[model samples]
Target: MNLKESEPTASASLSRRKFIAGTGLLLAGATLKLQANPLVSGAPLSTLFAEPIIDIHQHTDYMGRTTDQLIAHQRAMGITKTILLPSGRPVNSASTHFGVGNGLQAKATGNTICYGLAKKYPKEFLFGANEVPDVPEAIEEIERYLKLGACVIGESKFGVECDSPEMQKIYELAQAYNVPVLMHWQYGMYNYGLERFHKMLEKYPKVNFIGHSQTWWANIDKNHLDQKVLYPKTKVTPGGLTDQLLSNYENIYGDFGAGSGLGSMTRDEDHARIFIEKHQDKLLFGSDCTDITGHIDNCLGAKIIAEVRKLSPTKKIERKILYHNAKKLFRL
Candidate 1:
């Protein structure tokens, strides 16, 4: 699930019927060849209306990218704005890089980087502060980012469940500041399952938490599931826990960012349609992709967008997922 540089591999074996069922392309107008719409029209009246796209989740480090280069890559992919978090604290104090801090939390200086990006690309970037909850300064760091105008607080990759008490405290702060919290909800393959996600939504109604990666995608089932053993490699049929979460909760949202995350949801047409139709508003488009080459090609974005276009739903609900919902949620 840490897929920092991996390609899509999970659903590569899906058959054509399964693809149709998973993505819903078979139910739509036609296999509309996916293309970048410079001037989009014929959009659904019910979908959220906003400009183009604003990718609310991403990470950027100085592997080989400059600020200008980052912005240019995003623009090419139709991203009007982006939210970035530092990779982590530096391992060596003598190193100029911001230390990777404790395994998952951002250092105080992380807020500085976010604030700086917001200042530089006021129109094209927004700040989301990342902090590890167990860190001594976690509470103070959240307050600092809020004061400095961070619109959101995390794509917090916890090695635990979302409903843990430590996370509850962070959710409390997010609720207080009216900022969204983006967290990685991946638990191998249904590690925490749907019940955990539902509990989080029930307990933290005021806090908006964006779900990402495999665990969230794997849970969307509406009926009795047909068990197929993909044996030691264990793969469940789509649409079990994920569908339930989307249909039941308004505050809970999905961030389709990781490669496995994207592949699981979009590999089949029926699965894609069910996901799009049932949770269009709840799904937020993102790539979880970084690095200079990936940015330039916007590879992840292009691939997922093509998958959505292939579905060709009666409505272009994708616009809302890819852009407007994020704009409204982050107030970007």
Candidate 2:
């Protein structure tokens, strides 16, 4: 979560840790401090690795941001290539509430905007297509972008059941095109039904699935209550459903995007270290951040990259998540 334009906020009495843990939002406007990078001969991450880091998640025309703002934000965060996910349909503010666990709302951007950005800046941007599953024009609109050479087909962030027939149609298109599908798996909110998603996984073996959102990250805990507890700060017990899904399914992957992702890693550093090593091959780096500053103090995306850089067992594995895996998955 934590996209949208609203600044990070919490109750007056809450501490930074509690605020971030509770809201699952990034700690915006904090002071900047550079972390050491062992892989690049101790260079700061912002200035080094200028060619390989790929941001697998981002948006086009997010919060009314201009093209310059978007490009500057990515470049400053050390993102060499960005996967721009445009929204499928307009969101209903009444249904998609601004709760602590849910993502903030923004006006939907069409597939053509993403297509234009990726086309104009081929090296720096890659575009995706999306549409509300239940809408009659869903498959046809999505297929139009796919035919126009869209790399992926989602941020399938609509309020639909995970296994809805319309959603399956999107998966079928993904299978036909042989392209990866990125889904925002917010429990009870976006892409409903996390526990039973394995059926789709089994049914569509050829389509690569990338999972994101608070629910996806919270399920890193085996004991995660099957409800609205989005950012659980408890010590992680191994073999959680998320871990199991990543381990058991070759086509499934995790996106370390947004504050919920950072929260999962921060909840228990020890668990994060072990989890990184175990699923190094399946994890993908994606920062579903909305800030434009691009500084580590303000950018949630850069912070996720920093966490991966600090925790990966090896630089090779780090590079795989940061760039190579997406390159192979998206054929970039």
Candidate 3:
């Protein structure tokens, strides 16, 4: 399909912005506290695993925290390395936190902020370039950052289907640059049409696609029937699409971060254990938690590390999930 042909007309785009603005007011009343604590305790995850961790999924801006606070927080969690993914789209109307901006402006702001952080803390933080796949200058914008050493392309939170022609263009960019494409896949939010996403995997054999968010996690249970596809706490059944996809696709990977990731692991211990063991090499450790506490226990990030350690049959496998796998994939 020709994606450019499907682009919304100017009038339609304007109307959509108006609608978003109207709804944004209702959400603007809520606020996020992005301050950093003076004393951050690093004892939680440090006591759990001796191996240093590499968090492949994280954000520098969305939480409203400064770069210094972000670095301090990662250190507190024993994260030796972190990939800072910036969102290309505006903070959604329903979201109470993150700044309000969209499209090129937002993407530029995130790229500038993350790149600065990466430069300051060269060893600790690495950054990715984010672009809205459906935008007109997406490829050009992404290429500009890739030339400047963006190791990854994404946290793509655009309103497009996973297999849309627009996303294919972005995948081409990733393949050209030899970098992974990280995506946020919520059913109704960014990267819709998850059921047909396998076609993209088949097509882009060289482009690594890291899947995140509720829609991706929902498919972990083969019996997941709800269309809502957000935060399902029921016991997970085997033979889920996520497992099947990981087993079959070498380039596809899982970002185990945020509420969806921790919930998936904690919802069913037996299922999570089996899943982790089965796809140990394909899953990457991440802390999508934006909380400023710096301690893992203070947020779901700590629980995720603890769960992975508990479920991993051996220290070797635990290291693979928590640190080694990300090291290899991102080439840290």
Candidate 4:
């Protein structure tokens, strides 16, 4: 074959490679429609069959960016939908509770812009209202979102244990609404462990709890740790915490989002290979891309997803973590 004729066969070979390397869990009956040019400036596209993503966690400025920009960015990244939470400062090491007044100050007018986004882009964006237990009228505020069709509650930032009486009440409300509650779990600030989260799991039984941040997914060893070097380093080993939690609790799941989630997957590629293989069904893909103006381009969530996809040679496992697990969890 001459060079010109050989080019056609070579191009076809490359396209086949692209499709073969793409995300396998291509939704129910969805097929990949490859663009003529799958290469975006030398970086390969995830795959032509990349499953549509439903980001379970994302944040935006209350009075910040235009929804158009948010929607466009999400679409560009293959995110078909996302759950939006109000941005709150991390207080102490525990959860940053947001009351009605607090939400207002944070510029998250409960029924303002976010509500509009949900109404306008019902398919691509979901609104999750934040409720701080310390506020007496928190329940009422929660009802407002429920009435408006908010499916989940919180990106609850806490520095305390999940079993606190205040947290119990939040779980109760979640059960009442029949929705899952999302919590940010990290080691440093005010950290809590699997035992604490498990306590709540035991108490509520009915409330579905989804955990995020590094502390939640670090898979730390519950047996022992040198407390001195725990902070940042996090005394736990990979596949430790998640393995136990998924095995013990039926309703609990972890969000692979933010620095912690990305850190866990990248810190040790070998461990990640084993961890994802075992707990693939228990992990949900999310990116803590809450702030609109910061770190959007720099966020490596897409890369992390691609990296995790490579851990296993087969696409079955990747499909589970990328979308199926989350789809079944969120009932989307």
Query: Highest TM-score: which candidate?
Result: 2
lDDT of 2 at 291: 85
Candidate 3, residue 321: Cα displacement in angstroms equals 0.7
Q: Write the per-residue lDDT of candidate 1 for residues 51-97, one digit (tens) a residue.
A: 56667766554344566556555665666667775432333331111
Model 4: residues with Cα > 4 Å off, grouped in runs? 1-50, 62-66, 87-111, 188-194, 221-239, 290-297
What is candidate 3's lDDT per residue for 1-332, written digit by digit as tens? 88778989899899999999978865664321112221233333444345788988777754466666776677767787788876664554322123333532222346777787888777677989986666577788788878989999987776676777888998998999999998877776667787888899999999999988888887899999885858888898888888788889999999999889888888998888889889989998988877666665586777788888998988999999998888888877
- Runs in model 3 lying further than 4 Å from the true structure: 1-50, 89-109
Candidate 1 is scored at a TM of 0.70
Candidate 2 per-residue lDDT over residues 155-205, each given as its tens digit: 887667889888899999999998999988777778888999999999999
Q: Considering lDDT, which of the candidate structures 2 and 4 is the better prediction for this target? A: 2
Q: Kindly report which residue stretches of model 1 are placed more than 4 angstroms away from their true locations once superposed.
A: 1-51, 62-66, 86-109, 188-194, 221-238, 291-298
Error of 3 at 45 (Å): 14
- Each model's C-alpha lDDT? 0.61, 0.80, 0.78, 0.64
Q: Give me the candidate number with maximum lDDT.
A: 2
| TM-scores of all predicted structures | 0.70, 0.81, 0.80, 0.72
lDDT value, candidate 3, whole model: 0.78
lDDT of 4 by residue, 1-332 (tens): 58877566777999987776664545322333334223222112344325676678766654454565566456555676788875332222224432333442344434345667787767667888665554566677776787788778876765556677766777888898888988876565433554466777888888888877655655543532433333243333543655687778888887887777777666667767877787777888886653442233554566556666778546887777877887887788
